[model samples]
Target: MAADLERQVAHWLAAARTFRDAEEFASLEAWRAVERDVGAPLRRQLNTVVEELIALGDATAKLIATARYDAAALSQAAAAVQRFRRRYFQVDVTLDFIGDAVNTRTSPVLRAALTTLDRLAVASMVSVLQKANKPVPRVLVYQDKGTGASILRAGVRLWAPGAVMPCAAIKIVRHNLYRPTSLFHETGHQVAHLTGWNPSVGAALAQALGHDEELRAMWTPWASEIAADVYAFLHSGYASVAALYDVVGDAETILHWPIGDPHPIGWLRTALGCAFARRCFSEEGPWVALQRSMETRFPISAADTTLQPLLVRSMAAMPRIAEACLSAGVPALNGRPMTDVLEPARVSPAALSELERTVGAALWTSPHWRETEGIRIVALAGLREAEHPETASVWINRARAWLTSEARAA
Candidate 1:
């Protein structure tokens, strides 16, 4: 049994060595040549993660060799080697995700555009970490087909591997390729994860909305989504909420709340978004119009008995909920309010209009604008698309052209 286990341990160790550069994983070995590549910082991160796992495998191999012929000792050694093998496989899965993302570069320009836009959103949010002297992770974005966008956040344990995800791997849908405010929402996940914003927001909601037990229960559990939505709104203004409405569909979806799901009901979510705009920007802007539109489009009168009262109560509590998200003191950020870290007024209608007016037509033509204020440009485009229904295609194309060029430039 000892001899058999020794050979198996050797095989596991051998497999781990394949993680080294120019070895079994083509994603790590030839990562740079993969389309335009995920860039230098991510390449370095990939290399570092590979080295650490390889070192762990080496330690496991050394420990197994010292086990000799003792049955109990060999069993312990085998378990250690098994752990090493499992982590080795986890690394493989991570690299494969990166490989898949880069592979999509071979698809339409829209795919690459979504990826670029995602990275910009991530970088914009991660700037908070950089400000606070915290380490930032490299980001990877891939285009996928889905009704909604999602994220595998950085600086957190991955879904299966339990390994710290090295990069913010965001999955943006192909449909919303032009206006991907969902990218900001996903990066908000990373930001909230790293800065401990979710729990902080939860605490704030509990304190502020505790007067109504049902409203407290409904919104408190949905803290993560609320934070992400606020992050999206701060970066993109009314358009983020409008884009959310576009994806969430009819009255059935807007009013339905599934217990234990992290997302609040669509009605509350959109209403809270308008509340955020009201608190941060002008009260009479597109958000008020959006709330009125939601009511008209998905009337509360159609709601069933169970959902009817809950939706009404949730709607009334939105202003307070929005205040909690905006003003929550996060310990990870050294107890600073979210508004202190991320200014909502930056993306307000007046500010976005001023940005365009100041920059002239160069905002669209210049990659510098895409580099410095790409996040706001996406917001401006989405807001313009909402405010001016006729020029929607033009604004979308302008953002698309800038994004495509930025992707190529990167």
Candidate 2:
């Protein structure tokens, strides 16, 4: 089932990249024309798969919601809910350029594209979960400002009505004036929570580090974000990485840290993402081999190597941190083992190779590459190397060249 979900995710990512690349040289009309040429067959396939999954997800959710509770039943149902949430409620994303400037308010085409993308993302997520034999969630995607906050509010409201556990809602905000990848990164957080991959390590780490502001700030820090990146890497592969880069890296600036939040620094996030991917695929998989090739092609800096120590330290302290949080009465930090939710699955070398190839191709062809921020490129380069060291050196060289050229132009 896990293999199936991974493969399906790979397929959707490939198709998405192809569409994105095709659109680069084509206008809106041209892209639409191509979709017309191909959309029918694709849509038919997509619709059929999606509808069946939706029904399955709905049924599963109902059974769990109403079932009599025994310890075994409760455990099964909890696990089922976790799986269903991932299958039914994961977000599918597409980015459209509104104009020379990203003007969400004024861009009719962008708005329309966002709406279509949201619907497709929802459908695809639902179908993939069902394919994996998991139940689905009731999902809603918001396109306006404050989508995340609003969705949380709606979830609270639904809880009031005693609707099946408050459904997960995601907001797919446009990257009009800011980096779109940041939004995706946040979405990754939402996905991690729903999918049950987010490590229950933050609170543990915070407690271990002591309860100062720094520790409090670190409480729900990059562990969740990093987990999401790893999930995105495994689930969506390179296109997911590319999408992240596109949204976070700006063509005009060296780096534009997100304006308002205290999220971990972006470059670090990217680096950790790549590292996690490498660790996941380093074994005997073709995907691992390909990732090895990519990594070797793209080497990162020595200074950045420091992240490994931090990650290790955090990982080691996680259980202790969770224990501390539990003792301290922080409900959010109470431990819930992710392994209970996500069944273990292996990615064959072939699968790893396929993912690397697809992601490499996507990175080369992504429209946002030229415009992406330098730090992000560097971080991704590191991640790619960590995942596929064979390819890292070459990829990093290419990245460095791009960075140099951009710097020279600036």
Candidate 3:
């Protein structure tokens, strides 16, 4: 039994050393070429967690080696090694996701387009943070199939204790890749986090609801998602709303709002988006058509008894919520209404049309135009596709050309 205990300790001692080798096994050099802003911060976070884990392995090896222990003591040492092993796997899973993000350049088709898309996010963030004079963190766009699009925002706690994410790792779906207003929506989440925009919008929505306790409670929690939606709207205008409507699917999806979900039900959500567009642009084409499509596809009169009233009341109050969201004072914007800063008018259909005409051939070809107007051009393409479904391929190819140019310049 004494010899068996010694052998067991030796086994774990080797296991612990093997754990330390995980840091080098991945050969993180592939990530070395990531933009310095992205690479530097990511390396710091990764190093902090990895070094601490490596140090633990060293300590664990020392503990098991230096002691001659009873069976109970040996069990404890083995358990310590097991715990370290578990923690290592957690970091490993995180690195896999990060690897997925940074290794996107592996494929030629995705490399340029996604790279330029990453730059678009960085540029948009810079525009947002300029007023506050905060440094813009880098963005990494990776492809994944999941609920619409999502972001793992910078500064959020990650797998390892005390490890904060260093950049916005945005997941972009393949179908929406060419017409990705949802990119703006995910980036909007990071913007809201950085600017502290969510709670402020929640408070304003709550106050605007006045005496309606249930409605106030319902909408207040939705502020983060709502703020992101409006942020997407500001940058992409009706394109965001149209993309949202398309993604929400048919009657069943539009009518269904899962409990405890932070998103407004599609019923209220579509209405709110269209309302915001009308508020900003003062008239609506695609927004109104989308609202009608959502409404008539699944009429509320036919909805379940419980869902109908929530829909009606929320719809009635949506314009007010929309008004408050865009109109309310925001300290983050130095008390300017969001419209003043984000300038929703810039992406409005009329403005986009004029931009399309003015930029003409340069819109697709000019590097200067790509840098300045790439985000808007994407919105224009998406909005046009929504309006004239026939033009989808033309616009997609054009956007792809623009993105390819951006990558070549880089």
- Can you tell me which runs of candidate 3 are displaced by over 4 Å? 1-33, 69-76, 406-410
Question: In model 1, what lDDT does residue 372 have?
Answer: 86
Candidate 1: 10-residue stretch with minimal lDDT: 28-37
lDDT of 2: 0.39
> What is candidate 2's lDDT per residue for 1-410, written digit by digit as tens?
33333344444434333432323423454334222323333234334434544554555445454444334455555555455445433212112211111222233434344333333333333423444344444333334553122223112322111222223344555432121223333344544454444444455445567734543454455456545444344333443444454344333321223434434444334333344444444434333343344334433322246444544454444444433322222123233433222211223234534544655655533535433322233334434544565785686566444433422333
Better of 1 and 3 by lDDT: 3
Worst 10 residues of 2 by lDDT: 92-101
- lDDT of candidates 1 onward, in order: 0.76, 0.39, 0.77
Q: What is the lDDT of residue 237 in candidate 3?
A: 90
Q: What TM-score, to 2 decimals, does candidate 1 have?
A: 0.80
Per-model clash counts, in order, read 0, 48, 0
Best by lDDT: 3
